[model samples]
Target: MKLSLFIFLAAAVLGPELCLATLHNITVKGELLCDNATVSNVKVELREHDTFDPDDTINAVHTDSSGRFEIFGEEDERKLTTFYLRIFHKCDATHPKVCTRATEYDVPEKKLDSVYDMGSISLNLQDNKELGRRYDRDSEECD
Candidate 1:
């Protein structure tokens, strides 16, 4: 019984490491745009379908003033088979709205031997007609 318990414990710890060894480092670059223009100060998040929870967020990055961002993660054939980009627009100084419009990149399963560089993903913000009308009303009220 003691020997069996030891073997189980060892496998539990080492099994994950062994499985993750097949993963390669991947870099994804992308740009966030709003109103047909590049948007700065946007938050970008990369989530894998195998682990879609917040705890499984493989990589998180922010776009620069030019709306350019790069996210780095372990490219695992088992984990990163399907991934999606979550873009958030900082509308206010303290609030960030989740831009539902996002770009999904489907990576080839068999091509995990090397680093996969997903070049430039473009994201467009969701058009909120209400917000536009509210802005117009607020401006009119202020004037």
Candidate 2:
């Protein structure tokens, strides 16, 4: 009987928070380019930025042979969702120490619930400050 009372109080306290969950959906499409050339097989990941917790990956996909990709994701979040695209490629990887360059692009909140077309994105590491570097375990040298 005591355990049942505890559970009831717990649910009563948390139920409202759970009920406040909202569903957010977004669609993003774009083409990747490197120096006016199409970049295929590049990894594109849709992520939700979090303040206190690790960012969540909504979906991951690779650019097609034409360097175009489309991703759709949905999440049940209690707060407003902030989305971004993380593009992983070796476009400007020149130094042997660098393997892959990760670039980020923020998605505007107005674009939610509708298709956001990024058109053509040319990746230049020097011009982009949102660049991150990491190495591929299989390859020791940059491509």
CA displacement after TM-score superposition, residue 64 of candidate 2 (Å): 0.4
Q: Which pairs in model 2 have colliding backbones? A: none
In model 2, the runs with Cα more than 4 Å from the true position are: 125-129, 136-143
TM-scores, all candidates, are: 0.53, 0.90
Clashing residue pair totals per candidate (backbone < 3 A): 0, 0
State the lDDT of candidate 2 residue by residue for 1-143, as single tens digits.
Answer: 99999999999999999999999989999999998998999999999988899999999999999999999998788899899999888887777677788888989999988899999999864555456557763575344
Worst 10 residues of 2 by lDDT: 124-133
RMSD to truth, every model: 8.3, 2.2
- In candidate 2, residue 106 scores what lDDT? 89
Predictions in order: lDDT:
0.55, 0.87
True-structure lDDT of candidate 2: 0.87
